[model samples]
Target: MKKRFARFKSGWSLNRIFHDVTGALFAPLLISLPVWADAQPIQTLTIMEYRAHLNSDQPTVRGMIKFADLVSEGSNGRLAVTVSGATVPGSPEDQIKALQEGGPHAPDMMLLVTPALRHVEPEFEIMDLPFVVHSDRQAHELLDGPVGRELMSRLESHGLVGLAWWENGFRQITTSGKSFIHATDLTDRPVRVIPEPAFVETFKALGATVVSLPYPQLYQALKSGRAEAQDNFASQILVGHLYDVQSTMTVTNHSYSAIAVVANSAVWRRLSVRDRNVLQHAAIEAGRYERDLIREQAKTDSAELAHHGMTVHSLSPTELARMEAMTEPVRQQFFRSYDPKILDLYRHQIGTRWITR
Candidate 1:
């Protein structure tokens, strides 16, 4: 019996049994690895997407497309974003809702140029006050500087996580019947304004009867004569082909409009920290690209407006000073309505003397 037990514990038999049991325990794990390993790294995720009347040829839309492309590349192909331009089912307000409530079941990111955010945060309209920014550089200084960062940081409470500011260039006035070399030319004439209160008030202050209209309807309004005058960035005026009806382009440079690229808070939280950093970096790079594109296009569109038979008029240095003077009342109104600290920080960063706040 002792001799038989010793043989059972010897090399080949014991080794064979141990190997068989080990294989049995790990067989399922080995077979299951390919299925687990081959799984998609990302199933569904927040993506930056836009659906606006902005033409693909327009700088804003071009910037948006480039932004999406950068994000996709930065994600190493794990992230995908789709950008759709030219009129959507609803107004900018509706798009914001879609992002907020996840109406389509998942809210992605958006590059919005509208002041609809005033509904969520009224202070946003302060940036839209007429003639607040004298040049694109000043706009950048305000946005990329302390003042802009503060405004952006305040957005966290408003359901929007502000990513970057994309320029839409300066808002210029164009009309079908007259050339507005002076603010008085707008007196009593109906001018279309965005559906924002500050815009409506500013135009009214400028002695025009303000007609609030959605952006998509502006070209039709001008053609149908519901409103004979409208204001937008030069690129939009050219892209919307409003020159067909509008006879004059006044380079009033009333308000320098900046679009905010934002993600809904809920959707933002869902991103892994690593992925979030990737998206934020991509957004900053896209913003830099947009700024350069706009500076070039602003010059190009001014020439194009003239080539299209629209008389392009720029505010003279004297007239620009007068226009700058008018902004004080608007800025004062803003401080009274919003917060003085905002305007104070703006003055501190850029110096109060450069801009007559």
Candidate 2:
């Protein structure tokens, strides 16, 4: 069967069709279900995130905390969630492998980048195409709509259950000194890309010498001059202190970088009906909250980046158009990766949103 996803700038696969207020108002109600379980053992689930605990918590981290709280409350403490964001025990890759294994050794849930999920389900890469999603609104429609449900269904094949989409926000570009306002600026630049085909291919099309690396290794790559450029949300630049590594920030907003909150299918299936509703509902609500927080934080973080001596540039329509032109080939390559039905849905969703804009 064909899988699906929505293109989102906030790190995602979605098409935003519903009103923001609708999500906020009805989310709790949607999860409310008739109590069916009389007895259930208390269970503690581990939640893993890629970044270590920073001085300031990102909204994504905050959302995980919120999810944990709601689950405990809704389950009347029968379900407890423990969160781990540190890198000491293992890398994100290791954690993902563990979750996929899903016996006694796996995390119950993990918040992962959309690109990272692509490794398990290649169909997910459909949402990784650059410039496909024009705004966060469109992303929400795609994800919350049928397209997202289809993509989440694909997770079953990989031993995962996608709970909800969270935000990493629109990725911006950073360079050591040279800025890529236009494609030509990338000539000979060694850009650090997420370890994903879409990222590598996109940067190459824009004329960069690309290197793939783990998030932990990015700062050193820039500091040691092994790499001079990378992309991430503005908040990441501030919290990760990437400004110290790359002195220039351009609001390329080229592609979306989304993280998914997913559970091991085995664990999820073992949950009581009411508990499943509680956890999934809590995850969706937390995701919306996290997305809002990330958007708010980006405003202040960009200014802080400028104060910290990093040149921050927001793209004009002309330059954004240029970027789309440069990355056209990469988009085409991914366009054929989806079923015709998925593409048709994308066109109607994105095209409608575009006309309204």
Best by TM-score: 2
Look at candidate 1 and tell me the lDDT of residue 38: 26
lDDT score of model 1? Answer: 0.68
The total number of steric clashes, by the backbone 3 Å criterion, in model 1 comes to 0
Off by over 4 Å in 1: 1-40, 43-51, 86-88, 103-106, 353-357
lDDT of 1 by residue, 290-326 (tens): 8899988888888888999999878687876766665
Candidate closest to the true structure, highest lDDT: 2
lDDT of all the models against the reference?
0.68, 0.72
Candidate 2 per-residue C-alpha lDDT over 116-191 given as tens digits, one digit per residue, 9 for 90 to 100: 6767766567666788777888778877887677778888887889999886778888988767777578877899
State the local distance difference test value for candidate 2.
0.72
